[model samples]
Target: MQSQDVARRPAPSSPAGPVVEVEQAEAALVEHYPRLVRIAYLVLPSRMGRCRRVLTAHSLTQRALPRARTPAPAIPSRPAGRDGDPGYALVRLQVVRTALEAGLPLRRRAWPKRAQLPSPLPQVWGLKLFPRSGGADELALDQRLSALSGPARAACVLRGLERLPDGDVREVLTAAGVADADAALAEADRGGAEHRLLDSAEFDPCSLQARPTDLLRRRRRLNATLVAGAALAVCGALLGPPGDGWGPDGAAAPPYARNPAAQAALDPGRLTRVSPTAWRTSARVDFSVWPARGDLTDDTALLRRALAVWARPGGSVQVSATPGTPSGGPAGPPQLLYAGTVDNARVVILHDGLRIARYAEPADGTRGAALDFARVDGAGRAGSSAVVLGRTDGNVRYLTAPWVRGAGERDLREPGAAATDIALTGGVTPPLPSPALTSGPCTSWNVLQLTDGTGTRLVTDLGELVPAGLTAGRPGAAEAAAGAEALRTWAPFACSLRAVRSAGVRSVNAWAFAEQPLPDAGGSAAWVCTRAETWRGGGARVLAQFHTPGGRFGAVTARAEDVPACGAREPRVLAGVLWKSGAGTWYLLAAGSRDTVSVRATGGVEGSARGRLLTVRAEQGARADLKGTLEDGRTVSGLR
Candidate 1:
């Protein structure tokens, strides 16, 4: 029922010993046991387990390594077969033997000290032999290789050195490095008969393709040369002189100088003109013609007279004259002339170079009348006007003027009910009153009475009206008795009281007295009144008093709250008292003009009678000095 196809199989090689070459081992490993030790080492740790498992799995120990003298098992050869059919075991073994021989020796020679053979020796061998240096030498190598075209360089480095993955090698060579190295390496890798493929005519594909790197380098060099050439041309053009019908000097002439009309327009003479006129001068009296344009001789005489008039002490007048005439006329009369007005008439003259008329009041006898007309009342006497005429007795006379109704001249000899009024003539208006003594008290209401260097009176109540304290320095016994009685009654507590007459004056002109109240009757109080004649033919009266509380009073205390209600002008107050509770214990409080006072109880008896004290006053703000006393008899003397 079955037909057996007995296919002839090649003989299998025996396993070799440890001295077997790496090439033969590689062949055996690839053909017979592609992953034999790798699979065993994954599961076991011992070499015995690896050997046992490999031998048991392949039934190779009895067939190849029975006594270690024989070599390890080679890969069996493949049998003759149709496409896709399994080959003979003997053919696989022979192929393994061939590859092991070629690869084993190479691995041993390249790495003689390695204890164990590494897998994939051919690929590793390629990588080890390839130089990894990436410096100038590598750059030179890259350049030299690049000259052979992209495909050539790619195939040489990829297949010979990098040994890149198959897919990448194919893509890089085909897309970029289209060179014959692809066919050369492919043929060399194919075994036996296929090695002849490198010699074919189709292997020269790299020679037919353009080298992109060389093309790029050439283009860059060409562009640099072109750029340099262009720059040189531009520099030459710029450095050369201007050409193509430009001016000989190669600069345009000024616009104004090129046009005569423009130059003429800019000339100053054409823009404006100046004309000269004769100098002019004038005088006051000759109103007919000003000296500027009139008969020069007559004008000069009048001018001299006018100058004499103003030359008087404290007299002055101003005159103005115009120089030119418009319309180019024969220079009309001085266009305007003004003379000081005498009396009440302001004089102006309009002369046509020949005649003059004065529109002024005549300076006849009325000049005296005009001077007397402007008078003023004397000081403190209204309506009694006086003329300011120099007196015949070398004294100025504020001569009284007679009153007149309406706008008529008044007589200076007889004024009305008012006193003398001084008259101011010429340009003066009225006379000011002379300085005299004013009849009023200086500050206090003390009356003053003065005589012209003769006598003085101080009319104050300290004399006759207030007999409680009056003293007069007199030689008469009656006057002395009267003075003593007044001092005893008014100042009974005073320590002393007397009235002494001036030593040099037998007239009993000066007085001296002193009085102070007794300390036991409360502190001393004193009052002094004086009457004296001033150097200015005037008199002055003054009164002053001083008072202090008695020594029996207690120390004055102060607090901030009590200061506001204190009836003192300055916010701070001063307090002083006599006696203390002990030698070192005394209460004294004093504050300067601007200072505040404050106190705090410090380790003192709280409920004792001495603590129940009153505050006199305290300064209101920080100042250099503050004064206050404590109930315990301590005083704040000054800021510490």
Candidate 2:
């Protein structure tokens, strides 16, 4: 009876795991070679230099496979969380252990470990290899990593590169001879390492740039240098003194070598400016048919300076662009939309079909200039209704389309507020506060009201060259943002547009998917979803909001990036939020579309309900997860 009872009991947890075959480890090492090297590179000390680190990382990863099958002592409860293969797990652990040991100081009292010395194989001659330079963020991350200790660096790499949890990290570190796993994890947490930066190209040893080692100095004795110098001398003597054409380029990308196409692109007189009546006769109603308008349209010197600055802005110029938009020189001479002296700055607007670029310079001098670009690739009549002219002090002025018969400014939050008529002088509207720059609260949002042949529409500034269009109703069949009903619907969510500011947003639409009756007879609440579609055909953002009765604004309950949860193609969305009723009772309220057959809550609070709604009584500070079954038998998780 005792023996049978002992057999029924489960085996105790062991520190050692099943041994993996050498062949299996070799396959994993070959398949995940790049990822393993990147982990090693991140764990190694930055002071080793990129070239040495790259080689050393490769060497450590290659040597990770054991000569024979051995027990893997760092197995977690779930293998799927770590590549689902014991071979991959074993190799990764060995690489991390070796990388950590490499960063330790050499002890003079005893012979050094093989990992502490420089790598011998995979060396490149006469060249220094390193990853391409990244932006400011990458530099900051590199400096932060360099300040951390060896074990701390390994902990961070495991957390970021391997995406491992603290429990697994502790197991792997302990199995690798780490004396105090908790101490390493604490040091890593205290360093405040931004884990996202670990995936950037700056730390990717696989993507590298190789520059000649001392080649510039060594090339003095080469015949090719003599020939290049002699040729340059002759060309300089024949050209004599250089003109403004060859002068210092402020901030423009220089051409590798001069060509006729590039020269024509930089010429101001070559810019295409269609006639005033061209749009009427043209077959395509795009930027190409719009006539150039402004007081300085015919100013040759001003046009030349604008073109020069547009081609290559100097170092003093501040340049920016909307998301997914390129801020580079045009392929050829772009069409001029407007050129004029607006307020204290000289402004020029250009259109190349795909983008709208605004170039602005101080009236006194071009010492301080700013260049901004926004993508408007397929803009037609309604989409191209307006372009931002000048933005100053958080105030923006717009140049309406020629077809825009009238323009006005209205606060979306105040649906009953009187609209202020904006006088157009040469088709330019006066400066008004932009929602993109509003701070502190979501009290008010100002939108551009344009009246054209198609009726009235609403557009709001999001710190871009082209204001984003606003609409209402369902995704594909949404109508223009007009009428009192549309204004009231947009009022509460108008401030939410700030989330997608400078994201190359082409349009946004708000849709009411479901209405649920609150618990304890707290009155019904509305569930609204807003989707922002960008010009680049991707990166659509969706937000699920919960609006309670008598609340001035809806609270954002769930959000997702680049998902189809609440977009045109996929209109169905499921979400839940914790709410405190006016009577001081806490409840977990959830709602979904009519298509959701049943909704359920799990974890902190448990409940199951039929149809598209679920309500559960919950304690304060409770955490829960939610899901819903669709009519088609598919399950959907709440957007996060």
Candidate 3:
């Protein structure tokens, strides 16, 4: 039959009922389903970057459908190039809003530690990572996108990826709760400018995963804890409890106060994995590599290119090369030594030399070889860092320290027999005016120098280098110095008591740790700080509030009387005092064990407190806890 015959065949109508309306709704949905999923895939903030279009798109569509539908009105269709139908725009906007609100908290809570990317040489920025290349590169791109704050990511996706107009972008961001959509858009634009793909390239659309048959199976599940013959129920804590009440002074505490576990749940990036099961507070990595050469006469062009390949922006590592000789030996064929810093703490010295020798052999055609490595150094800070050395072979090494063989500095081991010309390949060679090969106390920053037949190249670190003198003139060092002085003066307690490394000012953050020795619960009872105040100069004055899963809460304060006198064993405690301005700005003067103390914080509400004292009941190798009340009469106890 002709198409007109099929169109006229619908004259045999069925009785009006829920089934008929549902069938009409399903037909309409099927017609528009692809576009809806595309929009959702671009907009939904899946922290892991998982495909959720099939799940969330349908949910949003069903929500907007009318319950009492009168044979679903025909959708007003438009040209494919235009914004489609006005009705579609309205529904799409609703989906976008729901995606942002529902998916914000679910954003990736932790970044899988990744090595710094090679520098963007010849080009200032790295190549745009293509989703078509589904491997480490794609993971890297996903990581970068996931790092952005919620509103910033939304703006970037809508305006940059989806090519939405400015008006539409603004509306989307504003709906996502961004106060200043313009500023957010600008920031996102700047951040994404360097990473956008070139127009000449193209990629295939990602294949969609299979959809589940039953997506709307809503079932209620409850978790109960039995203690002392009573059941305590925990449910829907992330959405929070019912009431919105104020403290006695009209100050606000978080609504989910009683549930410390929920309060402790921070945005994934803020939580640093301390061990296999524990997390500490910290900032994301901001990576940079500085290329250095002692004198201008040395050829360093090749060195620059090689260093460029190693320096990726916003990576956790700050790798620098220096000219070094083998242990107790003469300058062994000019070597470029390297150092690694993970999260602005712990520095591992590259002891072995990447010996580059002249070989009059043909290019083996093998790309590079990688070797797994481990830390062979001191305690505590040992094995917390990772490094990978790409050699003249094609294989890439995977290294996460503390548990690998060949426990020594990474040697970008040159392929021995199948060798070729090192100079032509831009490998790490020796530099001029050789640097002193000495390992000492951890400093504010570290330096790395690379050299080859082309010339010697100096690489400055993104983080501050130790001894201060080494950081002269390389670029961005003066600002680092100023920030260093600020941190030293404003938060001396942190400088003295907590272990810190010099991170670039752009990525600096404060972490507060209130530790108690709880041998029964693994090793120590460490509480993440829940409040902080940044000083005008540099460092932050932090507030360590102690709260247990068992319903005890208190703040850390400084008081001389509360600390144990010099030799008193039973009352061996550390304490500090806070002086608050009338405006509620608080300053802290603190002291504690020089070796064991460190500061950490995550997702804390910022506020001011007056008449506060930080008293820590601590004994050298015994249990410790935070005690004392704020001027507002909030107290915490029963921490075991």
lDDT of each: 0.25, 0.80, 0.29
Model 3: per-residue lDDT, tens digit, 496-524? 11121221111222223334433223233
Tell me, by lDDT, which candidate is best. Answer: 2
| C-alpha RMSD values across all candidates | 55.6, 24.0, 27.1
Error of 3 at 230 (Å): 29
Candidate 2: list runs displaced more than 4 Å.
1-257, 281-283
Error in Å for residue 156 of model 2: 63
TM-score of candidate 1 versus the correct structure, residues matched by position: 0.11
lDDT of 2: 0.80
Order by lDDT, highest first: 2, 3, 1
Give residue 122's lDDT in candidate 1 (0 to 100).
Answer: 19
Record all residue pairs in model 2 with backbone atoms less than 3 Å apart, i.e. clashing. 250-314, 251-313, 251-314, 252-312
Give TM-scores for every candidate, taking all chains together and pairing residue i with residue i: 0.11, 0.59, 0.26
lDDT score for candidate 1 against the true structure:
0.25
Clashes of each: 47, 4, 50
RMSD over all Cα atoms, model 1: 55.6
